[model samples]
Target: MSRLITIDNGGTLTDVCVIDGQQVAYTKTLTTPHDLSRCLFDGLERVSHEVGDARSLPALLRTTDYIRYSTTQGTNALVQRVGPRLGLLVDDPRILEDLAREEETADLYAALVGSRSAVLDLGVDDETLEGELVTVCNRLAAEGASRFVISVGGPDGAVAERRIRDLLLAIFPRQLLGAVPLLFSNELIGGDDDVRRTWSSLLNAFLHPAMERFLFNAESRLREHRTRNPLLVFRNDGASSRVAKSAAIKTYSSGPRGGVEGTRALARHYGLDEVLMVDVGGTTTDLAMVRDGAVDIDWFGTVAGVTTSLPLARITSHGIGGSSVFHVTDGVLGVGPRSVGAAPGPACFGLGGTQATITDVLLLTGVLDSSTYLGGTFRLDVDRSAAAVRATIADPLGIDLPEALTRMQDTYAARMAEVLRTEAGPATTIAAFGGAGPMSICAAARRAGVPNVVIPRSAAVFSAFGIGFSDIGQTYRTAAGDRPDDAAVTAAIEELLAHAERDMFAENIAIADCELTWAVVDAAGATTPLGGRDDAARALKAGGRVQLQVVAVLPHPRLEDPVAISHTAFESSGTRAVADATGTRSEVPVVDLARQEHGAEGHGPLVVEGPFFTMFVPDGWTVAVSGSGDLLLTDIPGSSKEND
Candidate 1:
């Protein structure tokens, strides 16, 4: 079993992939947010047995050298507000003063506002900062501040934090620093955006306790399976890296990274340099552009409404996942926004979900054969599904239950297609990864008019498969400060480079083994190279208004061609009618009418079945079916003429 097994837990699905040299095996499991590793390892166990002899599970794991996992644990913890109350220690004066004065959500991190210990603000002077750290650290420790984030207001914040942190450690003792997870803002942001920097630190602090618990459990489970190698988690920047007790933020985007990396692998296999990837799961639909076998880096984008202006992969996500609900109101029909989540799941799953859902409609319409879902882990209650849909949508719309069911499936397919077509644009091919993605890809592709599609082997756990495909890499960027002079800019550049080196070293990356690249976007948003012996050349050019970008990769580490990812442009939106998901049946009709009207003109029509709402598409759209059984739609304008 001299192989490596990896698990990727997305928001809605868990992907498992086992690799030995080039040979591989994979499987998928529904994500259990409460204890993700349990589901992840269970999936790995299932896949390993399928790949080898049935009796020797330990032998299989022992033959495996390492077990890597990428999880949405950090991201979910943030969204769910499932972690410790934190205290922010801002070393810089203006930043903390503004943060304290500004209202909660002023920077939009609403949940942890009242939750943060009052800012332990230290004035700008070095002497004042030293005094403040001792007092604040003692108070925070006393107040039960489980995590501490130290941020300083400076262009080279990372460099500044390192100096100040050592002083804090000297005063507070290394054991105290370890007891309370301390996140230095500069180290995480790698640039400047007071709000974003603050957000990053806060989010990391929030996930600290939960991540520790999850990782420890995963580590112990691996040991029990006779795995001697330490566990590693892949970073969102597309690289495998070891995780000490402290680095939890790196796991936030891990699931999506794996999918993008796996897509890159597929592109090279097909000799294609540009492509579009669409991953549709139970809670979100993520799309990305791949060019030259790598994801495009758009440093200036928003995630969950927070601005993270770092140059990582360019990907967009929407709230279109598998558990979308179905409903009808005021003589109109719709589906999704609400879901039959894991516990109850789809009505057809027979796990006691009484509500009607898209899976129910699919089963009623014969689009999904419940007997095949998860290889029949649970039996399908087609009768229960019919009763639910009939009671909710069909009866309300005054349409036959069967007709309503057909429309429900078709409409959802149409909406998915519109999203894929708009986001995928006129790119090379469409690749789908995720448990539901392959099943939905074809339907979406037909609607988008995309002619080529790839559902690589192990499409369900593609993200985990991608874990082994990408090169080890990291991203860095900087903000513009008011220009004083070339010398000032040079100082800034030197400071930034020094900070990057320090952070990389902390992560055990060798400075010489990494490649450094620099790019500058001027005040007018024009890009230019800042090539010179002096690192400050680019930062100086954009003084006070420039955006500096850098990416480092361990090239040729494995002595293979860099995966070519063909880049293409795509556009999409993430809108789920949250009110509908949690609303009562009486509210269904009005919601259905409003959503259906909105849906008719877009890619899909709106489907409403009691508390659920699903996306729908227009008439001219066609969908493609991928090998993994995903239904994808493509927007093929004027194709109606040929069909007519």
Candidate 2:
């Protein structure tokens, strides 16, 4: 039997899963922030111990068909400010230069600068741009700048961005110098959010060096274990793509993606049309939406407080997690954005962390296992947890430890519930995952008035299972001109589709089975069904049409520009207010229904679980699992293949 290995890097632990074609064995270990790979390898080794094949484990895992890794390397890099002071070079340096200047004003600018390129024309001359880029690179290199990011103004100028990066890299390979992970603004977001995109790119650069070494070390360790398969790294976007060399952004929020994917699958299995997945891990709580067994992807989700267009699920993250440290703020009681990370974890772990944390409260209150944390690999110190809670919370609130702990938990749950309510609205089932998720899911769901909560088997391994379920997808978007005509919109779609094809080709995806889908949100933000312009126009006119927005959904993951191309496109004024009287403001039509045929088998009350993630499938619902292994929920079980 082929073995599949999945790694989930939680805030305080690294959860590893080894699936021998069917039954899965899993293990967890403390995370080593200084060297994350240490925990990754350790987790894998432990899993090998469980399966009784330490010597042959690596070789078996190597010959395995798939290997997926999910971690927070990029996320950590940004949080710690570990990268070199970045010097940004822009095609148009007005706004970005100003923002960079402002950041420098806080006495934080050790070495950073922003300058405009000498190239003046749209059709960039390689000779001039290359020379100028090399000059910029040399200056930054000498001034102790270890990382650099370049952003040009126009959205369609990828060739220019590539040329500039290639020239600079010729002077510095991965080993010779710290990585300057080049991300062209246009390449990442399709359109221009120069400042935000540049910030995203810079953040990626900051994470590159650390992640490069981490992946290499992991690869080396795997080789020592006789593993020969290429490492399949999970991207923040819920897709597993092979890492060619070293790209750091791919691993950010790996654990969260697993939750989203698992939720999507569960939704399909149980036929739940709308779901809100809440996963509380040691470090953070993540909330995401799955409508009709499909999780939404913003293509460019916000990260580290910066927005970029990456193929990531639309997940809302809060600082509240299992190991979040608790403190009293002016005697009002506060929970955390700060966590008792891995080395010295929560007081409950008995690892020397004296801080009163969520885990401590859970342990003291009998909500968590005192003996089975990490399945007994690590022991919980109930005494330390109780003492910490009493010393910190009880004294501050002038109440007993139990009461203070209960109140603190209530407060955290209330805040999380409010956010979930706003995002999920009414009648959405809560599918909770993560080590702490099952323990708290029922209580949180009860508070939120959510009627159903589903907890699956091996809940801790849900994220790893999700790693097996996700598809490779890309979404490309560009802002439209204020007054776009149908013809103009059509032209834009064609251009985007062409670009999508090119991108897919670069990724080595086949063209025969590929498809194109488009979603257009004009300046106004209204959506029109693809090629249903007459219907869209009528909807707009019905409410004294002022303006409209448009969005398109492509069913195929192989589609190049999932958001930019379609023949029968959705078009509107681009805004809710302009969408007329009808609330059908955003229309998504299946341009190629054939793409949906790749359906996966599912059942009611389906519980899709993964390492550190779980997706609850409600009862009495039928879902369509597509050829891409994508889930689509239907209200009436097995009634319709297409949602529309």
Clash counts for all predictions: 87, 50
Q: Over the stretch 36-112, how does candidate 1's per-residue lDDT look in tens digits?
A: 77686678767867676673667777777666678787877777777786777765556655544646445444455
TM of each candidate vs. truth? 0.75, 0.69
**Candidate 1: 10-residue stretch with minimal lDDT:** 581-590
Q: Tell me the lDDT of candidate 2.
A: 0.58
Against the true structure, whose lDDT is highest?
Answer: 1
User: lDDT tens digits, residues 456-561, model 2?
Assistant: 4446667766675654444455543345566645555455556656545554565434544433343233333344434433332232121121112112112111
Model 2 CA deviation exceeding 4 Å by range: 20-22, 52-55, 98-138, 146-148, 159-193, 220-228, 245-247, 325-338, 367-369, 395-416, 424-426, 472-644
- Lowest lDDT block of 10, candidate 2: 572-581
Write down the RMSD of candidate 1 (Cα, Å): 10.1
Error of 1 at 1 (Å): 12
